[model samples]
Target: MSGFVVMGITAFAASAYVTLDMSQARPEVHGPAHYGLLVAHIFTGTVAVVAGVSQFWPGLRSRHPRVHRVMGRVYFAAVLPSALLGIVCAQLSFYGLATSGPLTVLSVLWFASAAQGLRTARRRRFGAHRIWMIRGFALTSAAVTGRLWGLLLGGLLPDADGLLVFTTANWLSFVVNLLVAEWWIQSRGYTRALPSEALKPSISSRSAQSSASVA
Candidate 1:
């Protein structure tokens, strides 16, 4: 329920921003090229958010593996392009280094995590794949967290400078989400459960049974 609400709000917000004219964009993204990149970022980023959320649902994966796989593909497809466009946009940010620096780092991490997830999945190391995907999705959620933080800070400190608010929000957005993802992965035992180790016991059990029958 909460996830749905967050996704709905994020989709609406991104759509709204994408529809805005170049002149209405932030000073750093006011030009036509930057505006177009922003639109692509928003569209693909929204697809990532939606696809990522579905990928995490255990019911969907357990009951409908095909759907899960499709969603996984969609998630990666959306994340890669979105992260690339985001890096370019961050580089062109008018908000100066303070704001762009963290976002630039975030874009790199986002792409790397998503790529790692894809790699792990292809290797059939599902536990590792889940961990990496969770990390990627956490970073992707920055768009929503950034806005929430901005709203809170803006209301609390109406006189604060815009750049300061943006900088603080940008840092907290991905950092907090990634930290929480790490914690969740640990709590779920995904980090501890390697595919080889999980198969070892079963293989050893089968060998023991075979030896006993021979005896």
Candidate 2:
């Protein structure tokens, strides 16, 4: 429910931004070409985020594998193009390399993670695919998390320079999310499972079954 709320709010905000006229867009993106890429990135990115969140829902994947596969396709299709456009938009950012550098790196990471997810899925390595997709989703969610960090920073340091706060928040958003995701995967024992082992019953379960047979 909380995830839905966050995704909804972020989607609403992104959709609103994309709909804004050139005159209403940021000064740096007033040019038609730049604005178009920005809009494209936002729209496709919003789709990716929404789709990615649904992909993580265990019930949906476990009960409706077809839906999961479809959603995964949508996520990859949307995210790959979105990340590419994002790289271009980042390069054109008014904040220059300070902001663009980190954003560009993030875009690259986003594309790589999504591509890795696709590769793993194609190889039928569902466990590795899930982890990579989670990484990709965390990067995608940077759009929301970055703004959140900005808001928190704004509230805490009302007098801080806006650009400085934004740059800091931007870096923290994806970096922190990725770190937390890695920690979650480790804590869940996901990293210890082999690609083939993932879909099989656990050793403990087999042991229990054997003991039951003996009884």
Candidate 3:
């Protein structure tokens, strides 16, 4: 987990380094609005990546539950704008529909995962929340994996069609990440908690409140 955190943060740093350069903004592609969207996407996506990883840290979650909750909210908030902007950016990409198609799908799924994660968490379905959040972060990690895929594909098939490479990379990015997430969830026993187990936290909190009221 620690290693994963380091890798996530490193990926964010690399993304920022590469994308945050104003000089690299291709206004000619889709004009100034696209540039703004890219900036917003990268910044909010960074927030999601960082907060998402923090939510998974055992020490942080155990010792600092309040902090965990706060960061979870942060992650949720960041994911919305980031994913929405990603979709817009994809549609407007000069790369045309071939490359944009998979990316648009990825952004939509990313948004849905974040929404589902928050819904489960709100219902006090902690185990389901964990699973959904894992899925959410898996999609978020596509920002990293997508780049890696592009690099690998580019290197392996230097003469490959650019459109094919971009499309393949975009699809593999979230597909592979989600597959790994599913495997980890099952192996780690993160399936939905039993009904009783799911209710324990809420019941305990209510009992504490009752005791305080009586006293």
C-alpha TM-score for every candidate: 0.87, 0.87, 0.81
Q: What 10-residue stretch in candidate 1 is worst by lDDT?
A: 21-30
Tens-place lDDT per residue, model 1, 98-160, is: 977989999999999999999999999887898999899899899899889989999999999
| Higher-scoring candidate on TM-score, 1 or 3 | 1
What is the lDDT for 95 in model 1?
Answer: 61
Model 2 TM-score on a 0 to 1 scale? 0.87
Q: Write the per-residue lDDT of candidate 2 for residues 120-177, one digit (tens) a residue.
A: 9999988898789878888988988888898899999999998898889989989999
In model 3, the runs with Cα more than 4 Å from the true position are 1-21, 26-28, 192-215
Say which prediction, candidate 2 or candidate 3, comes out ahead on lDDT.
2
Cα error, candidate 1, residue 156 (Å): 2.5
Off by over 4 Å in 1: 18-20, 195-215
* lDDT scores of the candidates, listed in order: 0.88, 0.87, 0.84
User: Which residue pairs collide in model 1, if any?
Assistant: none
